[model samples]
Target: MDNMDFSSFLNFNTVTVAIAVILLILLVSRSLQRPANVPPGPTGYPYVGCIHLLRNRNILEVFRELRGKYGEVFGLKIGPNFTVVINGVEALKEAFVKHADDFSDRPGGFLAEVVFKNKGIGFSSGENWKQNRTFSLSTLRSFGFGRRSLESRIQEEITAYLDVIEKQNGKPYNMKDMTVMAVSNVICSITFGSRFDYNDVKFKQLTSLFAENFRLSSVAGAAQAFPVVRHLPGDLFSVKRLVQNFEDIKEFINEQVIEHRNTLDKDNQRDFIDVFLLQQTKNGEENPVFDDLNLTTTVMNLFVAGTDTTATMIRWAILYIVHYKSVQDKLRQEILKVVGTSRLPSLADKPDMPYYGAFITEVFRMGNIVPLAVPHGAKKDIHFRGMVIPKGSFIIPNLDSVMTDPEVFENPDEFHPERFLGENGQLNGKEKIVMPFSLGRRACLGESLARMELYLFLTSLLQRFEFLPESPDKLPSFDATLGLARASKDYSCRIVKL
Candidate 1:
């Protein structure tokens, strides 16, 4: 009996001790969690961390509201990563400009690692980014980027695009397909040395793939935010679809590369691809950066950046001008006075046309394309305003905050071009008011080309026709299909010749 009692006591004591240890561990973890210096944000569940807010709300709207609730700089635990969002002018300037080197690194997650593999300029970091960016800038410059010489190629494309539109014969049509092709052709010319026919099945497939990637990327928001979730199987976030899209894009680019290789001309380089290939040969074994993979990704970067974003803005431009007839009328009057219908508008005419310039600036502002801008990562722990922004934290410079600041623009909600206009009806020096392309080290590399395209395309179109809604009673919805780029909802319009 004594032995039995002793054994029972020992078993009970063991069980009790184990329970106490587990509880103590849990308590200690809870106490030590997150950091005191981390910016305050909404309460989140373990592991997932504010994913519900991400899925349910418009991310930009959520960030804007959070800025209201938790001050200009706040923290969000997106999955496994702790993210820091900087809103307003002062905070953005500090993070992006002042602490550029510290804030320049791209975040490492499944998106940056598995999908992108740190290959191209947009997402890559450190030496890879430095090499690729320098080469891209110099190579593009050699091809007459940002110069009047490049304008001729764009004008040829413009003429080709205008011919296609003319075939519509004043009838109502959805301009999305043609417009995407037209804008893509400019980059295609520079990269592939030729543009696809409007009805080319392969080209159509490529555009569709690009659009699908954008949708999937936005859908992959949670996975990107919380990279731990990417390891799990099943297409819960459509991650598999996103990967497949990337594969397809690589295949398309590789096919082009193979063709270019077969017809090599080192001395008389045809386009960006030829130049890159020539460099690859010149560098040979010593070059670590200029690989075929880098070539593929850099070209992909150029196409996606040059095509979708610019095309989306042009689409928005058409919608806005149609919605606000007076804006269109004023734009047309300027173009007519500056460059008559007898000849196409030239880049030289830009200096003489300030109202048109203001209109484009307002379009960039009101369009709110690329609202959050590309995500920036902290290379090291950054101390700002009594907060320690942990190393590897995802840095979001809230561009929406800057574009829609109430103090900067009176009545921020209204689409008002006059805000950018001066008393003399010239392009006011309010260039800082809009930032559709983000600022600092990570500003869009294709900015010069995109600007030239927007100017020539907008002026040319307005000079030729009046864009009117298919049904004046019901204008196209201004609401955007929120994704990587904020694209306007599909709508039809009639192009009446001026």
Candidate 2:
């Protein structure tokens, strides 16, 4: 061989050996880096961790596949973040309930730093979170959050939405915006003491921003997992868009807060905003938790969370009923038998409608919205189930795993309401098995309100209208476009008055 050719071959071989040596060193170092009791997981690449595996994969599907290989508790390194996913009911309860404080803090990363900023009750942590959560829950409860007193306001929106549907004249129409408006109005009433028209310019702008935010926030999850990429230009990913969305939402909320401040009455509190204003005034300069920033973020939290989630579930309910004719007929039959057609359904009627309750339970399970419940943080280092959860490590309680556990629900994949019903056809409190609202200390605060909305809205519609797919043979796809919520694809159904 020529001398130059021989030299090139030698150089190539030398480079190859160098790469191999570096990789080996990296593998060994990563193995050594694991603390004593670290959870088992697939070994990721050097620096980037499992980012390559996660970049384009469906996160829920990835978690499910990982659960099969690593059991209920497994660790994943995406970018710079090391996250431990706790799947199934027992593991979830063990972490979130038994060891609540350790797993209660919100994980800090790009999302927390940028979008959330640890301001509101939803994602804030420590004593600030505790105080805000307690006050907000109490304030909401006083304003008829879980109690029967709040039913009238919800029923008002239900009646308004039903009128809109009835005006559709049984023709095919997309239920997305109108349905969201109906649900959002309840939140508006509670927070701002009023409801916006479905077509209001500002209201539409707000919901539109919220919808975009939901999609972008899901994208932000990647940044949370791998904070290294958070610095990249906004044009490359949704993080930039997510930040803008929050700004817009917060601006709207600030405007509302200013309005409430202008008309504050010491002895008279109309709704949540008034109560907050009073609290802020009472605290004056001393209270850090009741200021304008906290108020804006909390209001934003209530709306952004309250609107999309319950509305999406209601939309899913209609889609399920349309896809399964028997379920639709049975749900309608139950509604008729329980509440009758003379007047609107109320919370009082819920106990008598076991099938309805059971159906809602099945919907929560099948909807699998929030497939991975909002990521929690390890408040401190935790030794859980023979694994070490490092302080500040992200904790994901896979509610989907619990809801669909074969032990908890037979044939979990199939959409069967009967699984939630007892042998005697009564709702046997099996709804507890499906936790769409999450659980323990950090569980959703608006859960009671959401539940009441779902029952009243679904029952009201079924009492007056029968929903059917545009084509009897071609039902709307049960498949969801996943994000923070599993929203069904936009589909039009004929809402024939019965």
Candidate 3:
């Protein structure tokens, strides 16, 4: 009887081991499998996915190569997350514009989870995003965004910027700090109802934090992809620093919010904070979208999204203008003819100066600052272009592909502003395809403000100064250092007062 019982126990153990093995096999296979009918590309390893392909390679170059292999719509699984990269103008427009609702959501990752906490317009989605976006847009328009009414405020910052530059006395000086200071101050004026002094310790610290966080975000993207990395011992991916920087920024913004709340006048709204505070009162604290946290996060989004991108574009403009002296000369001639040396270029002059318009278009096209243009997410299971874009996949709009498409821009490789100009020197409609600000519902909230700043600042700068390389033989490198924004390498230029 004892021998019989031992044999029975051994049989039970064997059955249990066999079942465990089968389950293990199934789990591994499940991890390796791709969702049916998703866009086709590399079927990378489980968990890590195609992230290995990006190591030590330019992301743009990698995407271009993948596009060559996988067509316009391709898929990449990055660390358990499925990402779909959309290339070509038609595909992009279809995905972002035609199927706007399906692809209007923002992806959740380290950025949404840690940095933004799904509070702000940039990273948040659903009704919260819609309400905040709608309210912000309406409020911004009322305060002269995308209108000539706000140009005076911008011009005030420009006046201050030019004074700082003039103090340089045409010496070799990197315009990065001053440019960021000027650009950030515009957002400050809109948000805080005032601008900070250039030399103000807090202002400098705040701007530096913005710039540092921008750089760190690119590194922190790893943590975004593989969240496990964020939990590792050291801050290898800069996640800790990024979070700390964000906290510091939030604290600063929160201080402004507190001050605004105390001084807010319901009848006389001074700025964005005042407007938001008044709305908060109307909605009451229980309202999810207009709460204090959302207010701070939204303002943080404005400063972060607004400051770096516009400033980087300005830097790229300066670099390109100096690199292409002929383009610079022509731009100056147009400005001189229309706006003249006596006063800064105005929006009225913008209509008359097609060349200058084309030049800006070319800069937008060539600079491609926000190359990926903030990743979008599939709101639901989307059937796009005969493929299944599974719910929660990261949707990347490759603006670089559209901007640099040979078919769209003839000889897209060359830095020719005339591509945007017709034979009659009018802006050819090709500028419409150059979507540096991206497209559709989740398009940049600060688009109008950015465009206005770019036009005014660049026009005014060219009107006042001739940007020359540090030395005749040492022109700044045109190659951009890839970060959250494609930034121009640090290069000083002699800003000869015109």
Instruction: Name the runs in model 1 displaced over 4 angstroms.
Output: 1-32, 145-149, 234-236
Cα lDDT tens digits for candidate 1, 1-498: 599999999999999999999888885565337777888787676666777797867888888899999999999877767789998888888878897888878888776777778898888999999899999988877776433246777888999999889889889989887888898888878888877777889988998898788767666676786665667789887878888888889889999999999999866788888888989998893586989889999988898778889999999999999999999999888889989889999988999988877888888988999898888888788888789998988988889998888877889888888888789987678966588888788888988889999999988999998898887797899988787788899899999877
Off by over 4 Å in 3: 1-24, 145-148
Q: After superposition, how far is residue 149 of candidate 3 from its true place, in Å?
A: 4.0
Q: How many clashing residue pairs are found in candidate 2?
A: 0
Colliding residue pairs in candidate 2: none
Model 3: lDDT of residue 102: 89
Q: After superposition, how far is residue 367 of candidate 2 from its true place, in Å?
A: 0.8
lDDT score, residue 378, model 2?
Answer: 83
The true-versus-predicted C-alpha distance at residue 126 of model 2, in Å, is 0.5
Return the top candidate by lDDT.
3
- For candidate 3, what is the lDDT? 0.88
Q: What is the C-alpha local distance difference test score of candidate 1?
A: 0.84
Ranking by lDDT: 3, 1, 2
